[model samples]
Target: MDAAGLALVLATLRLSTPLGVAAMGELVGQRAGVLNIGIEGLMLVGAFGAFAVGVATGSVLLATGAAVGLGCLLAAIFAWFVLNQRADPIVTGTAVNLLALGGTGSAYRLLFPPERPIVSPPAVPDLVPGVGVFLLVAVLLVVAVAILLSRTRIGLEIRATGERAEAAHNEGIPVMRLRWACTLFGGACAGLAGAILVLWISQSFVEGMTAGRGFIALSLVLFGGYRPARIVAGALLFGGANALQFQLQAAGFEIPYALLLMTPYVLTLIVLALYAGRAHAPGDLARPFVART
Candidate 1:
């Protein structure tokens, strides 16, 4: 590829990293029959945590850990509601999104007011001078998740749980325990994704910085038909759409800025409209499991 083409490719990969990571986690949860729309909330909290910790300690490692920790905490709360209380996953997730939005905004204002915005928080160290460490991590996660879903006994049980939780439970699989584990895993992944966004991509935090990427990650799961390879491809497509607007503006294209900003979301809608119905979701997804006496 030429220089411009290479730059676009790199930017696409960088942009896709967060989505890919989050989507992989979501896939795992869905495979275990859990649906977490709270991924957006998890990511938002994670970004804020990473930013806050990074600013306080000036340590990227600490910030990343804080992000994951926060994500797990939030996900645990979510699991209690949906998994234990049998709340509606969609409604609970919407609540999570709202909570994160309001909570993060309030925290940001209280901690760093308009008079003093956050500046130069610690950044994730790169593996190579120009390439980010998380990018490699994202790629490895893809391979790992693919193998995890296809190769292991745990993978079979997870698939069985999603396909038929009752059957899996009857077969002696710990249905509730497995679901709990998957939900927490999803939360950790969402947090890591948030860390990548702040430490590697933005190097700063803003309220609602996730900007619907969580929802987009959900779509990516469906778009990829719940498969890892296809999900990575979808992430690349969305990432390319995101990068295209910047490239066009840089190249002095005459397109309106607002329209450029809409490219990724518009593509998301188009893809969903085209393929959502064709994709098969887990049979028991989003259904709260209640043990029968």
Candidate 2:
């Protein structure tokens, strides 16, 4: 590839890093029967948390930790309501997204008054040939999650819970606990994505900086048929679309700016329309598990 082409490829990888990680995380949760729609909120909270802590401590490490920790914490709350209280996952998840949006905006305004300027944190250094450390971490995580879900005993239990919760329970699996763990793990991945955005991609939080990427990741799970390798492919495709948009705009293409901006999402919708219903999903997806007497 030429220099310009190589640059675009690198940019695509960077853009896809967050989406890839988040999608894999959500894939794991869905495999365990936890449809976490609050992923957006968890990511928003993590971004703000990471930005706030990074600014205070001037430590990228602390910022990343805060993001992941906050993500898992929010996931725990979601798990409590959905798993223990039997709350509606859709309703609770939507509420969480709204809360994160409003809460993060308000907190940012309060902490950094109109008179003060927003400070950007240092970007995480590139650890690989062309990508940052977070991107490397995301790739490793994708590989690890893929292996865990496909090659391990816990993986079997998780898949079983999603496929047939009552059956898994009857066979002596802890359905509730497995769901909780998967949800929390998903939250951690979402949080890591947030940290990557704030600390590496954007270097700052702007309330809803996630820009619906969490939802896109959710769609990617479906687009990939809930498979790890396919999820990576979907993420890269989306990332390529984004990069193409940027390149087209940079090249002064005649397309309208709005149309260019909508490229990735438009592609996503088309793909989902084609494959969503046809693809095989877990039988027990989105259904809460209730034990029998």
Candidate 3:
């Protein structure tokens, strides 16, 4: 590949890392019949946690840990509301998104006032100068998740839960417990994704740095038809659009900047419109499960 081609390829891989990771987690949760719309909020919280902890301690490991910790914490709360209280997943997810958005924005402004400029923290060390360690980790995670959902007995139970919670329950599967675990795992993946975005890609955190990637990840899961390999392909497709826009702007294309910036989202909408109805979601998706005596 030529220099531009190589650059585009690298950027595509780098950009897709987080989306692929997060989408895989979402796939797992959805397979287990929990649709977590709060993924955006989880990512936002994780990004802030990583930024704050990284700046305070200057340790990449600790910052990443903080990000995962915060993501899991928020996910746990969300699980309690939806899983335990039987709250609507959509409502709870929306609240989580709002909470993360306002909470992070407020915390950021308070911690670093407008007067003082924020500095980027030390990034996760790269495996090779240009290629990030997280890229490799993401690949491994995708493979692991694929195996987890396809080859394991637990995977069967998860699928069973999504298909029919009552039936799965009768079959001796701990439906609620499995959903809770999957939800937490999804949160952890989202947190790690946020860390990758800040520490690996942007190397800094901005208010709402995640933008709508969380939503994009959700779309990706649907676009991929809940399959791991297809999901990664979907992530790459969107990521390539993102990289293309950046390349166009850098090469001084005449396209309007606003138009260029919206490329990925526009593609997302188009893809969804084309495939949304065709894709078959889990039968029990977004439906709250109540155990029967």
Candidate 4:
């Protein structure tokens, strides 16, 4: 393939980084027995928060930090409902997405009013060689997360807490605290992904800008069998499909454009159907652990 084709693939990988990170993070959270369904909404909030802070402060770091903070804050609410209040995680998660949609839409309008269909926007920053940088970062992050999830004591504790909280609790593990920590970590990753998108690609906060990548990421956890390396492969596969579609469109091939847009999702559904029963989820996957005899 030519350099242009290589670039296209690389760019697609970069674009998919945030989703990959968020998906892997969600995998960690879910592995511990918690069902967090509000990832999409959390991502939206993170995207908006990062963009608003980045533009105003002109510091990508600050914007990203704020986004992570917001993601964790939002996830806290989810943790409360599912972990403490013992509410239906699915319902609470839906509420989070709806809330994010309304909140982001309103915040964008109120903070940066439109003028002739244009809002006050800053340009997205590009790396000197955009695709190369994102690719390196993606690789490094995958390695780091893999080490964190599988090779460290904390990682083991995290898995222990998620897989069997009550059992871990009996063994003197702080199940609740460990769960909260992992969820917060997941949220932070989601927020960081948002910041990357806002600062490098989208450049502005839009209503529901995260699209449905959050949900896709959640599915990716199991599809990847909770393995960090596998998750990266999964991400690359999906991202490759997206990149190919873009190339096809640019090449002016005779094809229904809609198929390109839906390719990633269709792949996800297929993976879910094929792999759902094979993956070993946490023992208490969706069950709230309380003081039970």
Candidate 5:
């Protein structure tokens, strides 16, 4: 491939890294019968946590650790409310997003005063000559999740829970426990996704740096039919669209940049229109499991 082609490929991989990571997590949650839209919030706070830690400690590992812990922490709160309190997942997810937005914005202002220049944090060093380390991490994670969900006993139970919670419970599977574990795992993925975004892609915590990638990842869950390999493909497609937009703008395209910026979302809508109702989703997806007396 020519230099330009190689550059485009690298850019697409970089852009896809975070989306793929987060979507894998979402795929796990969905397979375990939980629908969490708060992934956006999780990613947002995760970005903040990574940025703060990287700035304070100058350690990429520490930053990523902080991001993952924060993501899991927030996901635990959301799960407690949804699974334990019987709250609506959609409403709870929305509230989580709103809270992250407000909290991150406030924290950013306090840490990065308007009078000072915004500085990008130290990035995690590249793993290869031309590719990003996080992209490699994402690929490994996708493979790991695929194996976990397809070739393990826990995988079987998770699938059973998503397919029929009542049956799984009657068969002695711990339905609520499985869901909680899946939710927490998903949150950790989102946290890692946030780390990839700030430490690798942007290298700074812009308020709302996630930029709807969480929603896009949610769509990828459906777009890929809730499969890890397909989710990674969907993420790559969306990432390519985003990269193409930037490339075109750099090449001085005459079209409005706003329209270019909408490429990924527009493609998402188009794909959904084409494939809606065709994918096989988990039977118990998005339905809270209430124990019967």
Candidate 6:
């Protein structure tokens, strides 16, 4: 392959890693009966947190830790509203998105005062050669998560909470606790995904940087039937489409840049149309789980 082709292939892997991680995380959350539409907001917080911490401390590891924490914080807040208070998941999720949008924008202003230069953080160090390592890691994470959700005791409780909270509650499964834990864990993963993308790959956390990646990941969860490996495939497919768009641009195709930007969304719509409803969601996705007296 030519240099550009090689670059495109490498870039594809890097771009897909974050989505894969985020999707896997969401798969876990949704499996446990929590629907977090605020992944976009959580991701943005993680991205910005990584950038800010990385720049201040000059430590990528610290940055990643901060990213995970921030993601969990956002997730915890969402859990409070949806799981505990019985708020509408979609409405609360949208609020999370708005919070992230404004918070990041405000953070930038504070970080870069009028006289200071706008500085991006140093790049995140790669664990192995090239971006392929992240892709490989994404694969491993999917497998690990699938095993956790399907094989372990804690996993069983998690599934129990989602599939039937009242029965699980009577069975002493601590349904609310399980939901909160899974939601927090999932959010942390989402945050780490965004952090890796911004600090290691994109090297910048510009406003609205996550764009619709969180939404895409959410859709992948539905399309993949909440299976970890299948979710990875869906993410890779979306990532592959994104990669191809750049390739088409480099190939001197006469398509408008705007059209290239639309490719991912178009694919999302297509996938939703063909694959949605085919995938089975947990028995109680948006239902308020209440313990029977």
Angstrom error at residue 165, model 5? 0.7
**Model 5 lDDT-worst window of ten:** 127-136
- Model 4 C-alpha lDDT per residue in residues 173-247, reported as the tens digit of each score: 778887887778777777767766776667777787887888888888888888887777787777677777878
Q: Which ten residues in a row have the lowest lDDT in candidate 1?
A: 117-126
Model 3: lDDT equals 0.91
TM-score for each prediction? 0.97, 0.97, 0.98, 0.91, 0.97, 0.95
Task: Report residue 198 deviation for candidate 4 (angstroms).
Answer: 1.5
- lDDT winner between 3 and 6, please give it: 3
Worst 10 residues of 6 by lDDT: 125-134
RMSD of each: 1.1, 1.2, 1.0, 2.2, 1.1, 1.7
Candidate 1's error at 167, in angstroms? 0.6
Superpose all Cα atoms of candidate 2 onto the true structure and report the RMSD in Å to 1 decimal. Answer: 1.2
All models: lDDT?
Answer: 0.91, 0.90, 0.91, 0.78, 0.90, 0.84
Counted clashes in each candidate structure: 0, 0, 0, 1, 0, 0
Between candidates 1 and 6, name the one with more favorable lDDT.
1
- For model 3, what is the alpha-carbon lDDT of residue 65? 92
**lDDT by residue for model 2 (58-91), tens:** 8889999999998999999999999999899999
Error of 5 at 101 (Å): 0.6
Query: Candidate 1 residues 108-227, lDDT tens each?
Result: 889988788447678777787657988888989889989999999999999999999998988999999999999998999999999989999898888899999998999999999999
> Which regions of candidate 1 fall more than 4 Å away from where they truly are?
none
Better of 3 and 4 by TM-score: 3
User: Which ranges of candidate 3 are over 4 A from the true structure?
Assistant: none
The parts of candidate 6 lying over 4 Å away from their true place are 113-115
lDDT tens digits, residue span 1-293, model 3: 79999999989988999999989888999999999999999998988998889888998889889988999999999999999998999999999999999999999999988798767767877787678888888999999999999999999999999989999999999999999999999999999899888888897778888999999999999999999999999999888889888998899989998878787788899999999898899999988999998
Worst 10 residues of 3 by lDDT: 117-126
